[model samples]
Target: MTGAWWAAAPAMLVSAAILLVPGLIATAPLRLAWVARIALSSAVSIACIGIAGVAFSLFGVFFAAWQVVLVALVLGVVAWLIRGWVPDAPRERVRWWWLASAWVLSALLIAVVAFWGVASPEQFSQTYDNVFHLGAISHILAGGDASSLTLRTLIEPQRAWAPYPSAWHSLVALNVQLCGVSVPVAVNATWIAVCATVWLPGVAWLAQLIARPFESGRVALIALPLGTAFGAMPYALLSWGTLYPTFLATALVPAAIAIPVAVWPPRFRVRVGRAVLAGAAGLAAVLAAIVFAQPRVLATWAVMMAPFVLYFAWRAYRPAWRAGGRHRRRAVTALVAAVGALVVAAGVGFAYVVFRLGLFERPLDDRLGGPQAKASQSVAAGISQVLGQAWPAGSTGTISFPSIPLALFVIVGIVAVWRGRRLRWALVSYLALAILFVIAAGADDVLTKLLTALWYKDRYRLSSALPVFGVAFAALGILVSARWLGHRAVRRRTGAVAFAWGTALVSALTLVVSGGSSAIAVVFALPAASAADEVVSVRQIQFLQDVGRIVPADERLLGDPWDGSAMSLLFGDREPVFPHVNGQWDPHRLLLAQRLGEIETVPEVCQALDALRVRYVVYNPHEFGGGDPIGNQFFAIHDAVGAGLFEPLLTDGESTLYRIDQCGRLPAR
Candidate 1:
């Protein structure tokens, strides 16, 4: 098969895998049930497609197409295998309206990706997460095995120094293998869009779980617009270009928590089934863990859900034990869920250990760098930080359509506090926790707050503030609209439905206008660094290619210690020491703190390279003597290493490389 056809093969495999399991086709007697399943299936397809696209980008488009096919096959197999185990209740008949809505939302997301990809593909390059991770994968896929220290050194320190999850890298690598290696943006965008869609059903399911036995069609209905608004934040879209994949990972956390809690009551009765359910819950937790390494996300979800889990267990067993029925059974089920979840977590931890996962291997980063820490000192302050960053910039600090929604939620929250609705009370408690997170997140001395968050074992990572804030506002809007629908004059069925439709319409319009405005601002803010430079010398490029070739595939070559960004992206073997963003945002501090600020004499430069065990140095003459070209602190060291201290390695038309050979002077005093 052609490379493109081969690239698309993985999608077919994943799709078939999901579709052909023994019970997959059997479970869908009713059209509505099938529709929901299909929607989910489609989501899986989209995610695989996106991931494949990104993986292939590093290789080629043909490989990307194939990776999508593989992902589809994998998802299909999983869906098919698990088909029989899913809850089998025929609820509302599948409505055309639902399908149409799903289609529209999917279309919008696709359009957004296309617009960005075609209009500004460079935005996706050299991001915080992608560069280090993708570059590392590129190194591996290029025939340099993972066993090399080059891979280890580049990946390990980041795991120690930075704060990002490992799923994106792992996923990218998988796609590269399946899709071939070109460049992975197409697949990455597909993954982002797919991930964005997962939240819709996930939120619906969560609403159902929260409502319990009482059908929550209304809750689910409201979730569509509100969930989309919250999920499709500017950061998530803009971040697609960057390596930060938090939004993608966070998309599934609520459902993971909800699923376990939702089934607790029914599963408490059956021994085998309950065990399976517990395991499923645990699996969900594991998935959430994989997606989010931050403690705030974990802590918030746990805090919100833990009480409910405890209450359910207590209520379920208290009566049974008092009435002479078996209490051990329920206790055992809860234990199974907890233990299963723990087992899953252990497996994830092991994968992390084996893979040298994340920016840092030690757990302290997650534990120490979160908001939970700040909350402990002063709940009020933590809550403020959590609330501030939870919403988009313009959405907060002032009253507007989006901001008004938040204000209304606050008002309803007050009413709920006075009137005493149990669920509403729970929401209030969540808000209180959210406020604490806000405070911690926004504080100036955030490091202290991060430590506090970490101390809770990173339980506060969920930062309950985000979901709580969004849900609270959406719930308030629903309550208001429901009340309007209840008026006698509006008692007509047509009027009520019309009102619901109107609410959705207004919400969509508001989100579109607000999101559009933000997108425009971002487009205009691009810096010169983003543009392609015409002054790049062919000789300089050749020098880098040559150095890359000389560096042992097994041994990483550190760049000119000072200019890690351009060199790391363009030439270095191992993942760079610091993340691309850190290098970009604080290159001066990083260099100065790391002592790259003092390499004046040839001996100093040579000694520094030797100390770091660097094999090759790709020098940029223009960057070295120029006025802090990127306005980074790179110039601080330029004056230290005056022209005479170095010898030329390569001189192209526009640029020259200088080799540090230890001028006769002794090392610095």
Candidate 2:
């Protein structure tokens, strides 16, 4: 653990350097102070590293340790030059006890969520996506290159344009290089770095933005604990997609939504510095970073950003055009310019996505998605799905749930904010996002297509962003109630004292309602199996480790990718004959799986090996996804061994490592 943390240090430092200037530049525009500045900086830092990796790749940098370090140094110099542009630092320090308390609670919850159910062997999320994710890491490590363009060409030859973001891979790869820890340990620690640097800070900044209307730090303070309390998200995604990148992107959603809205505020105001330009540029870069990370997450962000856009448009135009304000003429002119700028930015981003990213090369395809998993759940049904654990069964099992508590906060928040004229935009924004979540619950039809631009259709991923608005309203609800209940006591005690007590009471209630404790317990109940765990037992892993010692790292191993092939590639530090790339391009891998099962003779198996250009075959009976056809393939390997076709270099109870190079001659036939 200590070694892993030490390894993660350089990655963290590099990431922070990448974010510092942008974070400072975004401060005044974002009103990022105290903890929020740190949060935005951390999230932006992650984006900076991602941008650096792809940028370096585009320049044909091999993404070796030295090249990446040089890139980081370049970014550091740029940040230093820009550091002079930011001048809104507080003249005198104000101790924000509320921000401090929020930090303590948010850190506590993030730590619990980061490590709670996580353990060794399967140090990372052991969900389905683990196969591709782990393979991608090992795939990059195998060739010792992290070039985004050519990273996976070794395992996946078809596209050579595998556009998956290098944020997660790049960070892990850097850790592996600098830290000297195994990939799995580095992978899990990378999760912690993402939490501390991005999600925790992003949410803190977002909570401040949502609570800005009240001019109350209490809202920001209470929001985080309540937000982190919701278990299904951030934690649930671990089991769901093994969604590492999605988690990082979702963490930045609040900042993405908030910064744009903040740029176009409710009323006409003049900024008297380079901040106007620097902040806009910084925010644009931040948005681009996420589009690089996971383009699909931008959909939820747009939905959440819409009401704010509407608010900005209304405040900028209606009064000014009607000649209602003191500076009506100037305001109207500014409004037109602001709107025009937005149009230009939108056009550029659209061009980049449609022409540059190639995101929808096959949009309706299963990989990119069509109207497949349409939103079917209404609000209630969706809540049920979040809480419905397949554990303990019946009476006691359903005891762990999120709907009741979250719904309580939802209702309370709605009622509290329903009448605030100043918060109408905030209230409307929250309601709009909630409605989007509901609509996305079941239908990925026309509405979903229009909103998400057919980029992604799965509602599960969108739900991860739910806490942004949910926590906003939840904290507001608690704040409003606390203030109202404390109004009378203001006379007897100082208003601050009453407010503090009220905040404490509501915070406790939120903790219980968010089901933070239950969420932790639920993670344990949810089953997780790594590629190694899924396809091989302990004895099998033990034998493979021994075989890894004998099989030179230069030799590529031949085995079915869907089985424990990644474990060999990952643990053995050797490439596999097959790694899971998209199937349309690699149907031959399945054909190979089928052929291995169909072949009988030692020479025939050798012929198959010749195609892959390999001499080693690792076989396990309990290959993932067992059924008749696959069973037959397992039988073929067994029979080939029985025929004395290949020499078994190593054997466990039901698994064998065969050295195909030493196979005996086939009988005359």
**Candidate 2 residue-wise lDDT, 1-669, digit = tens:** 123344445544443343444444434344335655666565555555565666666766556555544444555565566655443422113247655666555644554544443334234443346667777777666655555555546445666676666567766776676666677666765665566556655665565555565543544555555555544355545544567777777877777765554444422233434554545655765676676566667656665665565566667667777776566777777767767656775675566556665546756332323322454445566545433311111111222243444455555666766666545666676555545545565555554544444335455465567666666666666556556666664332234324333443443344334443343333323222222334444465566677788776666676655456556877666667666523333544444554554444334545545544566777665444342332444344445555666667887656678876443332232
User: How high a TM-score does candidate 2 get?
Assistant: 0.76
Q: Residue by residue across 572-661, what tens digits does model 1's lDDT show?
A: 343333323234333323443244435553235445454444433344444222223345444433543443445555544433344444
- Reference-based lDDT, residue 472, model 1: 34
RMSD of 2: 6.6
Which candidate's TM-score is highest? 2
lDDT of 2 at 337: 70
